[model samples]
Every structure is written in C-alpha cells, then in structure tokens.
Target: MPRCIPIKEIKNTTEFARIVEESPEPVIVTRNGREAFAAMSIELLDAMRMERARAELYRLLDEAEEASRDGRVVDARDSIKRTRDRYGL
Candidate 1:
C-alpha cells in the first residue's frame, strides 16, 4: 500500500517530508482536496521507466508480426549498417 495518510492529516511539513523520504511506496500529495501528484523513491521511478521501455519494444514487435510472416523483414546486418550510417556511427 502507499505510505501516505490523507493530505488533511499532515500536521506539518516535517511529517510530510519524513514519510516521503522513508517510505518505499509512493505518497499521493493532494492540493485543494484533489490528488496533486505522487512522490516516490528514485529507485522505484527508474524501475518504472525501464518497465515502460520494455513494454514499448514488445508492442513494436507484435505490430510487425504480419511483416515478418510475409518475409518483409529487413536483414539484421543491413538494418544495422543503415542505422549506423544514418547516425554516423
């Protein structure tokens, strides 16, 4: 579970800062009785970003299945050369 109490329950800034620092889970900060945003440890944020990148790569592969089945895929070696040349790699 997330480690935050309601924004109303924050008696002071120190308690808010403490929970944000100590909790492994994210804390939802509210403003004007609505969710403002979440705060999480940097490690958790990086893990989430990596997971999103993997998901995007998988989506591209799935979309290309028909091209692969029809032998429309580019050669790996040619693709690598094209990419390297495009980027001056």
Candidate 2:
C-alpha cells in the first residue's frame, strides 16, 4: 500500500529521503489533506515505464492483427518502397 506523508513532513529532508529510499511502495506527498505528488524508487519508475510501453506495443499489435484480418494491409515490399521513396532513402 502507498504511504501518505503530509507536506510538512518533507521539510525533514533526511527522514523523507530515508523513507523514500527504504520503502518499496510509493510515497504520496499531500498538501493540506490533498494529494500533491508521489515519490518512488528509480527501479519502480523504470518498471512502470516499461509496463506502459509494453501495453502500448500490445495495443498496436492488436490493432495490426485486426486490420490484417480485415484485409487492410499492403505488401511488405510495397510499404518499404513507399517509405524509401518518401524519405529519399
């Protein structure tokens, strides 16, 4: 579960840094009982980013599969040729 910290707590930089470094879960900083921001380990951030990227990749692949099933795809060679011509490659 996420840990909620009041904005005032962050004033103690050493303690706040230690809390963030030691915890595996996200630390949610709140301002006046309202959520302000979140702090997490670099590893967690990278994992989240990778998860989002994979989700996007799967979504694109699904779209491609549906298009292929609908016979909306062109020949690979023709597509490559068009790209080459467009980019003067």
Candidate 3:
C-alpha cells in the first residue's frame, strides 16, 4: 500500500524533499481527509518515463509489422530518400 501523510505534515521544504527522496513508494499527500497529490523519487519517475517510452516503441514496431504483413509498406531506400529530400538533409 502507498504511504500517506496529511498535507499539514509537510511543514517545510526540507521535510517535503526528504519524504520524496526516502519513500520506497509514492507518498500520497492528503488534504481534508481526501487524496490530494503524490510525490516520489526522481529515480522512480525516470523509470516510469523509460517504461512508457519502451511501451510506445514496442507499439510502433507492432504497428509496422502489421503494416508490412498487409503489404502496406515502402522500400527503405526510397523512404530514406524521400525523408532526406523533405528535410533538405
């Protein structure tokens, strides 16, 4: 389960930074007995971002494979030439 703390407990910048850096899981900050926000380590955020990017890459590859199987594909050399011309590269 996530660790939760009342918003009032975060009295200062030092405590807030300490909570975010030291918590193994996201720290759920509550206000008025209700969920307010979440704070987590930068490492955790970076890992989440990387995972999202990897998932997107896999999805794109799957789409490309499906398109290739359906013969909705272009020649690599021709595609590269078109890209280069389009970008004036």
Candidate 4:
C-alpha cells in the first residue's frame, strides 16, 4: 500500500529527508484533506528517468524506420567521421 503522511507533521525540510531515508516507499503528502505532494528516493527517480529514456529511444527508432521507408537517410561514413571528430575519438 502507498504510504501517506500529512504536511503538518513534517517538522522541517530535513525531517522529511529523514523519513524518506528510513522508508523507500513513496510518501504522499496531504493538505486540507486533499492530495498535495509526493516524494520518492533517488533510486525511484533514476528508474523513472531510465524508463522515460528507453521509451523515447524506442519512439525515435520507430520514426527512423518510417523515415527510411520514405527514402530519408544518412551517409554512414560521413556520420562516423563527424562523431569521431566531435568527440575527439
């Protein structure tokens, strides 16, 4: 079950950090009986970022495939040389 905590109970900003450290579960903060904010650890944030990146990559690959079907293309040799020069590789 999702953990829920009130905003008033939070003594200060650092206290919230302590609560987050002790529990990995996401905490939902409420105010005036309404949902207010959410908190998660860095692990959760990193996982979310990785998931978003993977989704974006997949979408780009799909677009690339569609573009190639329509005859849009890039030169492999030129692309590789540009990459090497840009990165000093």
Per-model RMSD to reference: 4.0, 1.7, 2.1, 4.5
Q: What is the lDDT of every predicted structure here? A: 0.82, 0.94, 0.93, 0.86
Candidate 2 Cα lDDT to native: 0.94
* Predicted candidate 4 versus true structure: per-residue lDDT over 7-66, tens digit per residue: 897879898887776666778888987879988888878878999999999999999999
Pairs with backbone N, CA or C atoms under 3 Å apart (clashes), candidate 3: none
Q: Which 10-residue window in model 4 sums to the lowest lDDT?
A: 18-27
Clashes of 2: 0
Q: In model 3, which runs have C-alpha deviations exceeding 4 angstroms? A: 81-89
Model 1 lDDT per residue over 24-61, tens place: 87888787767777887777788889999999999999
Candidate 3, poorest ten consecutive residues by summed lDDT: 15-24
Candidate 1: list runs displaced more than 4 Å: 5-18, 75-89
lDDT of 1: 0.82
Error of 3 at 3 (Å): 0.6
Query: Taking the tens digit of each residue's C-alpha lDDT, what string does model 3 give over 21-83?
Result: 988889999999999999999998998899999999999999999999999998999999999
TM accuracy, model 3: 0.83
Q: Give the TM-score of candidate 2.
A: 0.85
Q: List, residue by residue over 1-89, the lDDT tens digit for candidate 2.
A: 89999999899999998898777888999999999999988877888899999999999999999999999999999999999999999
Q: Backbone collision count in every prediction?
A: 0, 0, 0, 0
